[model samples]
Target: MPVTELTTDAEALTMTLIADVDAPVERLWRAFTDPRQLERFWGPPGWPATFTEFDFTVGGRARYHMTSPKGELSRGAWEFVRIDEPQSFEVLDTFVEADGTVFEGFPAMRMAYSFEPTETGSRLRNVTYFASHEALEQAVEMGAVEGSQLAMGQLDAVLHDLREYAQGKGTRTELLDDQHVRITRLIDGPQELVWRAHTEPALLEKWMLGPDGWRMSACEVDAVAGGRYRYAWEPLDPAAGTAFGFDGEVVLIEPIRRMVTTEHMTDTDYPSTLNDLSLYEEDGATLVTLLVEYPDRETRDAVLATGMTDGMEASYARLEGVLVSLPG
Candidate 1:
């Protein structure tokens, strides 16, 4: 097991677990900050986590659920209290209802995670501060200790395979669940440029065009929260296909880091989908992750059947070419 030490202080009302990870501090920190990596090990073996919303900023909140083997879901939420980049961060963790209401019966805790370099690789220190002695006892009874050990034990594999997740990988898609899908691409540019390419109409028009012989005829975007964006595409030849477009209202925006929107076909009765886009920069390249939540499994399958991934890949490849010509 990676966990080298586990201790609880009744007087302090805290539980601390220290694990020695065979990865650098930077990699370890990214595993925690990135929801895709975090979900891979946040839950025990049988209970896998799926983060529906992850806004990684101070005062931002994350909502996730762990699914049991029997298909039962245990919901949870985390309000980020403090963040120090690749060093340490703290959060207020609480059990919540599926709709995100806090469950008062369960114990809420202040959890702090710290990372430091070790001779082999790095060391992770996780401390959970309970509200009271009774609360700590309650959590222990709920298998909190064993559960944490198992969760951290699964982290090694994730760290070892980090490069395959985002580096040099072309646009890739992962079916997170029946309704949610994750698409990731590593853009050969900095986060600022990548964010600009996504939000700026002029930049978007240049590369957002999908397959060959298509052009972005109309591109209007208001990147602020509550703003609306419309994009239309037309084939160079009329024989290709009919012109189509999409419109969406931005639900949330966090500058260059994250954006969430509700998207829909311009004149279709189909239910709208939620698109959560996040950008993270490491070295000189930025990793763009888009978490799309469709209405249902049928809708998701239908969308994939339309060769959506291929179109996305074409656009992303074009985006990289555009970024290369921009002034750094």
Candidate 2:
């Protein structure tokens, strides 16, 4: 167990937990910031967490749910209040309903997390501030202390083998649920460049083309919240396959960090899929995680059957080449 201390003060209306881990401060920060690593230990044993949405910036909100052994779900959310990268952050943590609405009568808390370098590795201090003594007592009675300890106990293993998680994985896909799929690719570039490649028409036209013999015939991008984007592709020879394209409306944007959009086949009545794209950089490489939420399981399966991952891999490989050629 990494936890070194756990305390609750009724008069202070606060609960604090401290832990020391055998990982560098930067590594520890990544473990907390990356949703992939976070989900590995965010919940107690027998209750694993799945982050449906994670926006790691001030004023952004993260939504996740923990599943119990018997399939019951406990949903929660966090509105980021402050962030001082690699050092500390704070959030308004709240119990939420399935649709992300705050649960009525549930106690919400302000949680602050601070990370500092230690001689061996790093120390993490997490403090939860309650609204009142009654709220503090309620949290304690609800097993907050034990749950937190159990959750932190599992962090060491995650930090120990960080590289094995997603560093070299080309283009991997995870079926988060019947209606959701997560695809990840670690691009050999910075977050800003990758974001630009996705947003700039000139940059996007160069690499968004999936495979050889196909070119991006049209590339129109408006990458702001409520903006619309359109992309179309055609084969070099008209015999290979018919031309197709995708269009979407941006639902949310957080600059180079995150974007959420609704994607659908252009001119088709097919149901639209929600695509949540997040960028996280580590050791100068950016990880592109795209969470696609389909209207139903059938639709998700149908889309994946079209070799989506393979096509994405080809485009991503091209994207890396584009990034490398940039005058950095």
The local lDDT score (0 to 100) that residue 195 gets in candidate 1 is 95
For model 2, how does the per-residue alpha-carbon lDDT over 93-199 read when each residue is reduced to its tens digit? Answer: 99999888899887789999999999999999999999998888888888899889878976865786434556677898877568878688888888899999889
- Candidate 2 residue pairs in clash (backbone atoms < 3 Å): none
Clashes of each: 0, 0
TM-scores of all candidate predictions against the true structure: 0.61, 0.60
Cα lDDT tens digits, model 1, 1-328, are: 5889988899999999999987899999999999988987798654668899999999999999986533468999999999998999999999999779999888779999999999999999999999999999999998888889878876775787434446666888877568878787888899999999999999999999989999998899999878999999999999999999999898877688778888898888989898878776766788787878889999999999999999999999999999999998
RMSD for each of the candidates = 9.7, 10.2
State residue 57's C-alpha deviation in candidate 1, in Å. Answer: 22
Cα error, residue 207 of model 2, in Å, equals 0.6
Judged by whole-model lDDT over C-alpha atoms, candidate 2 comes out at 0.86
Error of 1 at 227 (Å): 0.4
Worst 10 residues of 1 by lDDT: 157-166
Clashes of 2: 0
Residue 201 miss distance in model 2 (angstroms): 0.7
How does each model score on lDDT?
A: 0.87, 0.86
